[model samples]
Target: MAASGHTGFKRIVKAAGYSWHGLCSTFRHESAFRQELAVSAVLVPLALWLGDDAASRALMIGSVFLVLIVELLNSAVEAAIDRFGGERHQLSARAKDMGSAAVLVSILNAAVIWLLLLI
Candidate 1:
């Protein structure tokens, strides 16, 4: 397999470190991420308490996490767009708009999931 660069526990640790770094960077640079994180902090615990069963809990929790994931992706897209420069361009605007739309959809998904699970 040509070593695959990293192996076993080392690969897991490295992946974890990268994931932590990404989370920190996203939290530091993105206000939207921070807001979502704050909301997740509250909702995740509530989801566990409010859910009637394991599957309901997972659905509620997963939906909230999905928002965080989408927000991170959107932040990444916006960062890449900014990296290209400050100049205005149609493509860059479109990319940013699309990333924003993805976040909105994820938020809506979370809302629907919570509502369905609760009622």
Candidate 2:
């Protein structure tokens, strides 16, 4: 159940606002996010043009979007971990490293998808 009592369209509107805030914040503070976004900007259009059919276009575009989604989640994880404090902790380090690894994997996934599709 939702705690805010918002339902239907109101809930969707609120959620969109929150999502926009997150995107803006990530864009402002996360250099990696910005870099990925820049790459995605180019790749998405290239996917549309290079794709042979609808399915190909969708798959190519989807792969790029997946990277952005993963990056957002990774940024969120790092932000939550950082919120705790500046003090070094094993768990915090592990969490951050894992987030970084996830981003790397997503990039590799996109590259493989593009390569297989284009080749």
The candidate maximizing TM-score is: 2
lDDT, candidate 1, equals 0.95
State every prediction's TM-score relative to the real structure: 0.93, 0.97
Return the top candidate by lDDT.
1
Runs with alpha carbons beyond 4 Å of true place in candidate 1: 1-4
Cα lDDT tens digits for candidate 1, 13-93: 988999999999999999999999999999999998999999999999999999999999999999999998999999999
Clash counts per candidate, in order, are 0, 0
Model 2 residue 78 CA deviation (Å) reads 0.5
Please give the range of 10 consecutive residues that has the lowest summed lDDT in model 2.
1-10
Give lDDT tens digits, candidate 2, residues 27-107. 999999999999999999999999999998999999999999999999999999999899999999999999999989999
lDDT of each: 0.95, 0.94
lDDT of 2: 0.94
Indicate the worst ten consecutive residues by lDDT in candidate 1.
1-10
